[model samples]
Target: MSKQTDAAKEGVQQLDAAAAKVRLAELAKALGAANAAYYQDDAPDLSDAEYDALKRENAALEARFPDLKRPDSPTEQVGAAPSAGFSKITHSQRMLSLSNAFDASDVQDFVGGIRRYLGLGDNAPLPFTAEPKIDGLSLSLRYENGTLVHAATRGDGTTGENVTSNARTISDIPTTLSGAPEILEVRGEVYMSHADFAALNARQEDAGDKTFANPRNAAAGSLRQLDPAITKSRPLRFFAYAWGEVSVPLAETQTDALARLEALGFQINDRTKTCDSGEEMLAHYARIEEERADLGYDIDGVVYKVDDLSYQRRLGMRSTTPRWAIAHKFPAELAWTSLEGIDIQVGRTGALSPVARLKPVTVGGVVVSNATLHNEDYIAGRDANGAPIRNGKDIRIGDTVQIYRAGDVIPKVADVDLSKRPATAEPYAFPTACPQCESQAIREEGDAVRRCTGGLICPAQAVEKLKHFVSRAAFDIEGLGAKQVEAFHTDGWIKEPADIFTLRERFGQGLQQLKNREGWGEKSAENLFQAIEEKREIALARLIFALGIRHVGEVAAADLARHYTSWDALAETVDKAAPAATAHRAAEEAIVAERAKAADEGRRANLSAARDAAWADTQPEAKAAWDDLIGIDGIGATVAVSLVTTFQQATERASIDRLVAMLTPTAPETRATDSPVAGMTVVFTGSLEKMTRAEAKARAESLGAKVSGSVSAKTDLLVAGPGAGSKATKAAELGIETIDEDGWLALVGDG
Candidate 1:
């Protein structure tokens, strides 16, 4: 597994069945939301690498426990649902998503799996077609009587959004074809070349409009526009690779099919080739990856497919993916850049994060000028555990550092080039105090980050939170951007979220104070007021996110809002859950202390047992509340504790109460309600022999059960396996029924 994949599945290997179930639900929710944002909204939430890591993690868990896959598992789905702006078109043939291969071993395994499935020997002859997997929108074009009729995007595999009018505007797409199948559907990618994408972004900036983030996003946005004229104004290209629906076969093999498509006036990727062996295919992939930056277009990876059409048909499909094809994704891109300077930035939570300002350098076709330094330890050539990194050669101001971008992830300083370091360059000294407020900064034990102790008194933290309140994904007030928020706070006009609503009443009373201010006009000031008033009634998820709570981002906020549904409900739950959260923290602290004191594993286990026994003595009501809070899908103790701690603070609670009084927060989006385990709380303990812990959890959730990590009075069912210890005993003590793995299988019944 890759480092990123390991990060995604951290602690999952040792998780009890119940905990794994909770994690699986969290992954499913996150992946689903990310897909919708990327495919339907054209605004991705996760980087390509992050998405891939999560997908890989989910697949690994599913493989470990095949029976526990969720009904909404990302592995069993393609792209998200199509946008409602365009007409819907059900595909004549499903557009399957290809499985991914990240390493050489994975590719070898792919070949082995194919050969084994076909009952062939190791030396069996097998030819494969390798081509660039275009990082653009997937489109399927239908041609009747050798004439192009319609075009549709690959939406949810089975249905798509109709974009025939916009597709006709692309210069690369042929309006008519000759000597083609009587009824055919040509499938390929619609992309924007690098040059065209850059030029289009420049034009957009000149027009005072929002520019795209990358070539892939630009191409998707351009091709999916409702107005064909707008799409025509943009530069878009197409490459035909496969056939969807054909009255007659295109060719006997994949290589011949591409030739036939090109001969029939359809543009095909010139890099497509036929490889005789897996080693040859890997060599071809390496060559493509090497030339990827110079391709003038985006290509995330290389796609390999069975060469013979008969072989492809025999392999067929598996729900949403094809068994005959796989995409070997490129690794993170790396480049060396000079470290010009280091800057410390304070976030809303008062953590000091170091950012490395670098000389402009291109990596994977993107010009990167800044990279993340992570923390002080990282700068000192060490990890959080004080282990040596980069051979313990510390990063200096004048050193050349190798920076890497993982797909679209933020760039990070990976390694230092000691050969290019200047002799005069000295080791960097991280700040001892907050740069914005001059307050003492301290690094807590076991934490890699150094944080300021200034709390809300720190100007940076206060200003950042205010800015977050009106960010695009939050309240999104018009005329209120980061700059405006900073200026307003500096001028003492607004100190918190509640102050924004009182702006007109306090500043607009007498001589038009805001209107007369520099860079402000009557219309603009009134517009800002109007925007603020319009957002007085906001969605519960947006309101929760705008609070700038620690570890609660847009997705987590949405999850919380969906669980609680109303501000009152969430506030009440948090208030009631505080005591339980405190007790849980004490238990955790006890375990940590035991680990520090214990000399061996046996001693530590004994201490843990004693801690669990003490934890069982907690008040039942508080435990129930905590259980309810943590039982929400995609939610866990980290978020629950943060929410409770924030609410426990007197100042924070007062501010939140005031803000809640000033605005109305609507309910969250409704979820599916019909399932066998609906409203039931399930817990799993000890070892699961039949299925992996993660798989069992997902399978239970698919049947509508809320999986909890700890045994509580609220638990409806307790699934135990061999070696089940304290948790099983506790369940039995609480008069809850305990079942073996076989019993669980019988109850869930193959999910």
Candidate 2:
């Protein structure tokens, strides 16, 4: 009977091992597919929770049957294959993956294993670094002599795709580092935070383009774009996590290495902490997990790395994961919930977005009652039969939709189950007029957005705009909020940007009255006034953006400021701009006629004759003035016409004059001629030798000479750096002189 029991036990063990092998194979394949979708294609097939679950299952099976683990298992890889579109690059040192622990017990067990391996005493504590595992694409950035040379996305640990151009577009990823190592290869994650991703997706939907699923997908897509221009448009950011290959050693500990990275112009995740023991690490993981939703970015787990580099070296690594580091993933936060109704929200730009009001459900440890439907098109399952669909078919009042809370904060409608939709459900009809202002809503050609023509008159738009004006990225006026903006706008205390400056006078009469109201006091009023005073002398770029000009953003504002120098100069430029010849005659007849005669036989003959007669022979004084105006960079035919047309309006001109009178503007600093290729017309094409194309362009711009996107006849000296392809040929055709890196350096007196 005992021998029979032993045989049964052996059979059970064999069955379990066989099942574990099959599970490991399945997990490996699933993980590989998910990785391909996430990294190579910039499209994820599985939810964050589902992906983590699969990964966890794979890890468990691998632990049970360590001998059956495959070399190409997802557990053994750093990242997926290199994206085909980007140039392939091999890393100097292979990027290793981390082992994982899910809970406090798991963490304690891991620490125990480490102590046993090190032969330390039973109660001995290990110092470690606990940091949020940013859910973004892993990348390696190489620097030579304090300047960024190249950037690559992690692909299968040993090899990666070169994303130098896209990486350069990230504002936080510095082109040149300060106090940097002689040669450094810093590893980090490129990501778009939740807020930025939402905003980006919103813009993309409004522009009638495909929207990203989440921040991770958006960051991956943006980073892998072939054209740097596309990447520049996305709000992608980077956070340094670890080192790849370095000429000079960093610090003795992981925490010190982080400090060094921060000092060298790399942005490190702010949620990193040092722990004296595994218990402290577990505590930190709990605290961060609790505060996860409040954070603007997505973090799937917490990473605990051995602080001491020497200790880490001693621990070494397994064939796959590092022995000194482990990832403590938070539990999955997704759950099924019923969709109750759909509501539409009007944004500051008058974009009407559909939102799903769901039966409250807990996902990722947070209660979610609402999910963003994105737009009308998203509501409907099909595209326009023939015509371009504006908004997706409006989501009906009642429909069963799959809801997901990414990072336990942003609730988004993932899918709709038409089978469960009510039989009585009717197609939702989008409003043709502004709900708040009764203004006509117009969907412009080639635009998906339907905006109200009421402008600042709409209460919803006005309040939102006012809030944006005082937002941290804008004027940053203290003591002002969405509620306060609405209150002030409702009371007629402020009407436009200029009204913000006049708030003291307009609200002075009601100042004492406001102080008497709830949540208002003398000190509060004084603080508000002081805050407003502080913003009176804002930078030219901020002032331009705060005005909320159509189609103008931070980058555009910066460009305008750099070109015009001050508020007055920019006002003069924009106002003096005439209308383009192609503009509607009724809208710009006078301005267009003033600039150029109509295309008629007699007019063409007269213009030709005037040109042949030379500047001295015909309108010499006017010619000199026109030449002076046209010579300015960024001032072209379209811009010049727009400026002239604006200035022609008496009301617009008066407003500009008033704004200029009330404000003081500062001049931008001139470039220094110390760097190589300074003051040279550098046209970067194909590839680069020393830096990313963006870094080279930025360097050239800072030094002086104009940086034109296309090679032109007027190009004085084209610095034909490495990767000089079509532009180099164009320069030769135009008889534009060209130089290599050494020649460019000599010209700039930096050789």
Candidate 3:
């Protein structure tokens, strides 16, 4: 299996604090190494898709928990530092990266967000230029007095490596330009055509030298050579679409600017078009994606930019990406491969996930060796709903399966080709017991996965839980990584989270001391101990996330922490809400049973009545407590049930208590107190003029207000705009305070 496939097994959503932290560190190290290998050494370590997936995963985690963002975060950095062999040239303007849009909705959001930020109406004439995003190295050519002065590669965005002589050697790049500004910096991509790249590789292979991986790598390697003669020998091309540090404005719009560059003897993509609406931009993007294979050069996606220079300037930029533009990336590529075997791997949650070991095959430049089987239902040609899939074709060993990979998501089997299935292959029988611990692996009703009943006794679960407890966003012991956790668990040195705190007192001076262990010494062991000691005091949110409660992810943990303020308050609330949560679960189960019986009898059942009857016996106090728990912003019944159920387990509760006793958890950061909307439940509806719904919610949350999706008695304020519908009417009927967009702006002091 590829390293990427191995890493993708642990989905980001399934990762606990520790696992996420460990994975984040791994991604950072891997991506940084890949960047250095690709940018500096011109030897790519990871495929483009794999690299993009890693970057996406890292960005997703950072977005989820901004507080846990690393100092060496790849999202903040552009490329590896300029290679030492080349002279560094600081860019007159930073060459920014465009944020990616993986789907149609993302592109819509990009356009919508810009419109919202600019306070423009939906029908406003917001023209955008859509063009293919070339998959190659970015180059900046500086021209003074219409004469080419220097050329540089976008090494780290701000500072680049000088490649002026090599740039001059490329026939497409003119040494002198006519009808150009006194000082014009033309920025574009440097690439090699597919045919040229193939020929070049053939020549290198015939000469017994290292062949390039792809056209991009070949272009990068050929251009960055110390000898310009080597670059001249290679067929390279340039496409100018942007400019930097121009003495005078090239044009009033992005379309005109590109046209100006083309007029100045630089080539721009002929497929570029000026789109007037989001729909038009997406249409152009689809066209480009459809024509990508025949484009004769590699293009990853389509770039969309606000055409108006004034609007672009007003949109400005984030830390790394411009707000006025985005790269609408192509969808996942598919390929056919033989499924050699299926292996069941248990996760931290005891989920028996089946992984397909495939005969390695390249899918859009990325080599696929493993793909997720999802569940037994998936392998049996059924979906989670027990509906037929792939025309009821079951996947078996030695079957030809179609695999697909999307942004950051693991590769999955899309379909099975029965025509190619081996005649000798038999149906796969999923294991009924935990492969590691021999415990009963039971598939619960309404769940697709078969979970092991071993709990903590299962080595897989124990070690995984322990790893989560010490993950970076959790306790974050410096030297205690996933490997160390496994080693300690195997050696019977640490079995639980609490055992970590007692390590020094129990074994520091004894013969079984960690320092005396193999591969350990005075310095390394001391550092581990110091790291553990440093985490004796931690934030409440981290502590909550470290517990590894089901459905209680980093974001949920933060919401819980912010709502409860302290550990004691959170524990007390859970204790009070447990009975109600359990009752609710009972009600749900009762409804499910009724529906099952009704289905068996070929009759309909009143599931709502069944649920009400089951929940009717709950005490009033328990019900009230449960309501309060779920009432917290971003907290729902699902998270509340998980929290309550986790605390209801005596053994687990005791373990948590023991861990808590050895440490002090700081209170969650307090929100703004003096704001008018502080402690209020605000719901936004209809056409917000000044800001988008997301912007409004974020603004409200930042000012200590709870932003709810629906209007109810609990809603204190309703910020309604034009075209306000049922929500506004409901708010008025509920007697909640109603305000227009202007009133809301005035209330928030933004007007």
Candidate 4:
């Protein structure tokens, strides 16, 4: 062959090789993104078929060219990297992920492995804590001096982002703990309830704002917001499951710690149980899976952790997961339904979101007719050819859409069939104005949302706000709920939350008559009134959050409460503070001046500092007027702004005044340090020398010294008796102080 011809052929071969590599890289990227979305975000960007196709292609490519596999390849990782917006915080004790088992055979294999690792006989019992694998963001909250000081998101298991400010927004997360240790770091998941998610989406639709794909995605997105104000707007809740760093030991068993978390006002998952054997654990998982659809929140699987800490220690860990724990995941529930039509929904925030009207199909025992379309881009598939797809392509009016009902009760459109689209079907045009309020709708720069200008006047927004005020995580008024709130509002029994407190007096005589009329009774009415009375002395944080103020959440309320000390003080300051227009004008002028003086040495920095200092000074004075009045902890400027804005109207102020008159603020709990074991760190090892594990834990807790299972340096005394194993040796090696059964008895004065 000629030399020129050979060179040309070689060049063509190289070009083909490069193109193949590019295709492989694209496949890998797509697979990784899909996995991250499904696992971390709880919002799958692709259907199972599409994802499986990509995975197969990627696997084939990797096999064809093993050298091309990158170090950060999707196949090598268990989960996605930690989010970047949060601050990195290294855990005192590594928070390990769990190994997953998909089927009964897998569960049997896992149990077999555990048996082999522990060297147990064929019928040896293996105790475990079977808990729901909450499909939400994992976080760690630290409390100091009986007060929450920091909250962090689980990043890479070892380190996390500091989201204390945002975490405070969850009402269930206490600002100041009761019966808490000097230093307590508890880990848990933050989630949104199905009811709240529905209301929030409805409000979003009413206001023409984009709706979240699912409750889990809504929760993750909310918790990850850099601005606490934004996070506060979301209906988020927390349920603690583990502990990290602690000054005092928590409890002898994992179950005890869960109870302690609950006593300290931290929410604990109610479904957790201590199983005596792997069989019991499996049974519990089966029971939970059967009732998973009825649960108020999303849960993907069940987590089984070794109940005996000593057994867990012996098993140790491997890489990112502890051998002591395993996740038992149920099969994903997917169904195929015809996409009959597309609908536009306006939200409370005024963003317009698309909804897929589907043929009613039973999924996990519930009939689902509609699924969230997410956004315009999502509906159009954001593709070049505009092929029918749910996640990556548009769904026509008559296309078949694959729907999946994961942990979330709501089904989401997973994929669309282009071939099934009717030829007469036309592209869906999203609405340009609010359907309810007929307000001008606009999409802002860099945002994927189209929002309406309408505010509180919209019926949907009003109902949603009312529901938020009485929500379980907010005011927690026992008898009032979405249905009741809607009924009262429609009947004029309550126009606002404050009006609720006055219903008894305004209609007391008529109440009895109304009770006798229909769907009411003397007992029910009395129960409701009692429930209302019970909430009269709620903490300032709850009260502030219950006001239904925009952008004011639990954390912000706590910050404002701490800063101002009193509601009256905050109200007056907000009333007198400069308006948003004034603040904007001042900022504009300051920016112009700074730009003009940019040439001056260090002038920009100095000017910026001065402006910041001035703003801070003004904020404290105003914030103090309100937060200091309430004596609540953790209330900040953002919360103050929300409170002020909510109470700005004369009607709102009057309602607040009435609420204040009917309510009496309770005194904050005082921190206690009077327990006999207050300063001691006690570890319970071996089959308890004297009492049952539960009895020993309770006794240790009563004495004030925290009781832990594993021995660590911080542990002051190791209470060893019978069956003491590796912990005793580790304690001895660390030179940690040890105490025997008799010594423990003498310390507690029971000798």
Highest-scoring model, TM-score: 3
Write down the lDDT of every candidate, Cα atoms only.
Answer: 0.78, 0.66, 0.80, 0.64
Ranked by lDDT, the better of candidates 1 and 2 is 1
Higher-ranked by TM-score: 2 or 3: 3
- Is candidate 1 or 3 superior in TM-score? 3
**Model 1 over residues 351-422: C-alpha lDDT tens digits?**
787778999997655677876666787788876666776778788998998876532233567678899999
> Which tens-of-lDDT digit does each residue in 1-751 have in candidate 3?
2333323222333333433444454455456667778888777877666766655556545544554554334655577668878999999999877666655666788898898788888998999999999988899999999999999998878899999999999988999999899999999999999999999999999999999878888898889999999999999999998988999999999999998999889999999999999899988987887898899998888999999999987677655578898887665656788999999877767878788999999876688788767678778887667667667788899999887664332466777888887889999999999998999999877666788988888998888788778765567677787779999899998988999888888884533477778889888888888888899999999899898786676677877787677899889878988889988888988988999999999999989888888888888878867876887766898889989988988888888999999999997665787999888888888998667776687788779987766676678999999999998998879788999999999999999
Candidate 4: list runs displaced more than 4 Å: 1-300, 304-328, 343-354, 364-366, 375-377, 380-392, 441-452, 555-565, 572-644, 647-658, 673-751
Q: In model 3, where do residues sit more than 4 Å from their true spots? A: 1-45, 52-123, 129-274, 286-299, 305-326, 331-334, 407-410, 469-477, 509-524, 590-612, 670-674, 678-692, 708-743
Sliding window of 10 residues with minimal summed lDDT for model 1? 7-16
Clashing pairs in 3: 18-471
Q: What is the lDDT of residue 223 in candidate 2?
A: 88
Q: Which ten contiguous residues of candidate 4 have the minimum total lDDT?
A: 7-16
Per-prediction TM-score: 0.65, 0.50, 0.69, 0.45
Could you tell me the lDDT of residue 574 within candidate 1? 85
| lDDT per residue as tens, model 4, 353-393 | 66788899865444678765656655666522334333456
